[model samples]
Target chain A: MEQPILSIQNATKIFGGGFLSSSKPIVALDRFSLDVYESQSKIITIAGESGSGKTTLANMILGFTPCTEGKITFNGIDLNQMNGEQRSFYRQEVQAIFQDPYEVYNPFFRVAHIFDMITRHFKLARSKKEAQELIEEALNLVGMRGGEILEKYPHQLSGGQRQRVMVARAYMLRPKLIVADEPVSAVDASLRAMILDIMLRLRDTRHISFLYITHDLSTAYQISDLMYVLFQGTTVERGNTAKIIEDPRHPYVQELIDSIPVPNPKIKWNMNIKLPSEEVMRMKNTVGCRFYPRCPKRMDACTKAFPPMVKVSEEHEVACYLYQ
Target chain B: MAANEKILEVLDLHVQYFTPRGAVKAANAVNLYVKAGEIVGLVGESGCGKTTVAMAILQMVQPPGRIVKGEIRINGHNIVNLSEAELRKVRWRELALIPQGAMNSLNPVLRIREQMGDAIQAHEAISARDLKARVLSLLNDVGLPERVYNMYPHELSGGMKQRVCIAMAVALNPAIIIADEPTSALDVVVQRVVAQTLLDVKKRLGVSMIMIGHDMGLQAQMVDRVAVMYAGNMVEVGPVESIFAQPLHPYTQLLIESIPSIRERKPLKVTEGLTHDLRNPPTGCCFQFRCPRVEPRCLQAQPAMIEAGPEHLVSCIHYQAR
Candidate 1:
């Protein structure tokens, strides 16, 4: 029952504003927050569909974007108010691995640019020999040989290899927290397992915390210790990975779980599923319930006001009218 | 089954791309059969020749990639040696393809209905009224509303566009539908829906299928039989249950172990190295570098597909005998 290693208190982020903006400023993160304790497993899986604010939440945690409202504390260090020098150090403590590894590096340059970029800012290595050693060490951790990986252009490497190089670059800094956004979705299907395995090792071998953002729940199940299901920027359900998956409470959570392709032919097509009519855009963007329109189990109060995050159990939390 | 009744039979199929280092063998001597009214899955990792096999079957493998030496028999006719005019007759009517990137395969500038109509009319002598009826029914069959026909490809969502592509592929209800990563670009939920629709279509029409994908879970649900490809070779294959329950190949085990399953959270076993570059591969087993139980036998030569169980074959010299 010790305090979590990291915590976020009611974080909210909104993008775009103006007279023409009749649509609600897509609430990228609706008073969103989560906790990560170092003792337990070190992966926090953030899941959502296209419009879900999964990426926005991850960016705010990495301090890439300022939260429009709310507090983000990493080891109780407020991310919003950090000064330039402090921010640079924070950058070292927190690193990122983007979804597309090919895009992470330039096609023209050798993969070593990643190491060079860090050396200019931080004293990653004491000397030329140390620097080479450091780079090779990081590459080795990502399952790459330095002789081939460091010299090759991004175009020359496979999607999985490129991602490994990206992870290696991140490892070079020895960050306490890593924000990986859909890291393996672009890679070939066979190569996906390899990348996912590397990430699993990251948490176990190095004690690195990961804020994994992905829409694929199948792989998400494998990597996450704790999962927070996000729908349209609001937390639909948050609980232990196995518990929530086995018996999801919220209707939206159930639908997301049911939507996964099980390895059975008998469990076939689901019935007339009703997704929200795009007209939900016209629904009063109020504080009551963002999911009511799409929610299968709708209530009178659902459309009237926004739902509150109620604790269903010691570790389980859900934002729904039923709880209220 | 009649020997000639096979919708598609690929024999000694080899597809290679000429790279700077040398000819990269994208596909090896893969022999497969797609009979009537059943589905076969071609599963493997990125470099495993899954996509290459699909493209070569369609004769879409352009320069750098030559069919080189093989016999692709679609509906008992050899497509490999066919002329342009003869190949044209075989393109859409006899063999249909739902290519790797479903949405991207579509012509963005054109309307959904137009492509369907053109495909149908190009081969069969159907009237305009019949074409309209056929396109609408195709849309309905794939779970899309009939109204999707009027919309542009951009207007429809990713899932919707994929369904439209599937509709077009089976517009003629060709004997075989080769869906190459049809749902790869879509999300899990969308993928399930799309996959379900394909199953429904296959059952209703009694058409044979060659479903190609990377995800074993998805492949398990859709295909009755599986052919696991690795570095252009059909490394392992059998009934879906047997393949999952008793995998014979080390690479197959590595792939299965690597996947994070929802039902179980076992520690993932990562293959040590990267996929071999086909252009300059290690002159032995494609999986030897990363195999869990590498040995001297594995380095001698690539293992041929040998039957290890009932309809189960493995192409690995380092197979651990039970």
Candidate 2:
């Protein structure tokens, strides 16, 4: 079998268990694993609500934070053990697009400054003319023109335009994977489709895989080929995006899918549905299923110990006592 | 008092922000109304004047951004020209507002009881004991627990904080509630829960509401009627089902088509072209620059709202000719 491009095995990230601190260590992510192959580019969605550790997973993968347990390897090289040259290569191979496009930019600099910094740091271009050509090419790939946006300051461009420029900046690196954290959450609906379409185009044409992290399931459903539904940092369900959305196996996944208000008025949500209080939902359950407090079909065994991932179908897996 | 009676109405409303540059027309001749028990959704892209219209309806347009010309009639009373003292009498008692990002709207330093108490006492001279009863009942109406009364805003979750805002909005039992994206900040499950809380509260109180948001899916599920805005102009208004089923205006159509659906996957429909500058809007249609079915006549003069179907209004040259 061919090696995967990126592989995460039993990754665990716990924060704030310092020597002097009295607060309990918060398990932001626990026992999460995923594999992305280089042969086929895909948009893999890591979806969960805020504080559900989706961002923590993204941070771990981007090397912004270190995992307390397990290992993450890129092209057979462990991220934690990478040397100086390998670290720079990994940086060039993996680029990121953040949630707030406005905050990512220096308000004082022109939009072109972002691309220029990337070119100088990565040594992608030798001369000014070569750098200009590269920037234009990257912009054109994202369906934007360099002439209109390059000279303008970050404040001058709209949210959608700024996001597209970020995409173009990531594309200029010619990275294998783009970690986009809620790229379109701040953009409007009309322009949101444009950004998501760019992700799809990049996957199909350029073979640039994407780790699309978002809380928005609708857009994730529209673009992601694969999905991992996280519940308070634990992988409740991992499978094909369409199949999981259509027939969500885990109880948390079921609730999450039911919560999305359908666009058609004919299909209204059942108004009688009630959710448990946030306090109960956020209670630390070290040994039991994290969703046991809120799960509708929870059993006594669910509280005894955490359930392992059980194969639901050929390509789908769910971690639930009910499935077991 | 009767259902379907117009409880709140905005007639030819114009809100302008006078910056160093020419006046930025925020809401231009925008017309909207809310019936006694209906939820009218005001939706548009950012900077398209959804929030401006909400602020104008509340008579809270800030300095440098004045209500240039219009009448905001609440319960058949034109409060547009009312003095601050006179407006205060009508503000919360008749027209309550659940402002945008309502999670952060709550005072972190105050308990939920104190904050809600402030809202109630500001409008009514209620006894302390009675205020406690009213606040608890208001919390119950929004499906919040009684324990939340003693908890501070920071202790509660985003969804709970939003429900607290909803409870406060109904504290005065106002004739109308303007919820500006009440569930925009929460997660999907939590957003649904908050949305359901809003619906339950509305059903119980029978208060007319104007829901301002950009989530088309949410608007489809919650609102009785939908109003589409473009560059500060109300382009289309119709029944919720009709607006989703057969959106008339080019911009409205584009807005609906752009919604990403969960049931199926298809090529996204992208709307190109930038919104015209608000400081100097085009003489003709506000959406003419981005309208897919643009005609030469559309650039000649601004199209007036014409009835395209039963109670459906559209401002477009194509609809006008029809």
The clash count for each model shown is 5, 0
State which candidate has the highest TM-score.
2
Residue range A90-111, candidate 2, lDDT tens digits = 9999999999989999999999
CA lDDT, candidate 2, residue A237: 91
Instruction: Give candidate 1 regions above 4 Å deviation.
Output: A1-7, A22-24, A35-41, A71-83, A188-207, A264-288, B1-4, B280-286, B293-301, B308-310, B316-322
lDDT of 1 by residue, B1-322 (tens): 5533677899999889987679988987898887788799998776678888988888888887888888998767788977889877877777789877778777888888898888888899988898899999999998887678887888778888888888888888688889988888786666777888888888898888899887777877788888888788888888887887778887777666655567776665554466777777787787887777878877878777778888788888755343
Model 2: per-residue Cα lDDT over B44-157, one tens digit each: 999999999999888898989999998988878898988899988888889899999988988889999999999889888899999999999999999999999999988888
* Residue lDDT tens for model 1, A132-242: 988888888877789987877888877788888888888889888888999988886556767787788888898898988998777777778788998878888987766
TM-scores of the candidates in the order shown: 0.90, 0.98
- Against the correct fold, how does model 2 do in TM-score? 0.98
Q: How many steric overlaps does candidate 1 have?
A: 5
Clashing pairs in 1: A287-A306, A288-A305, A288-A306, A288-A307, A289-A306
Q: In model 2, what is the error at residue A10, expressed in angstroms?
A: 1.0
True contacts kept of each: 0.53, 0.89
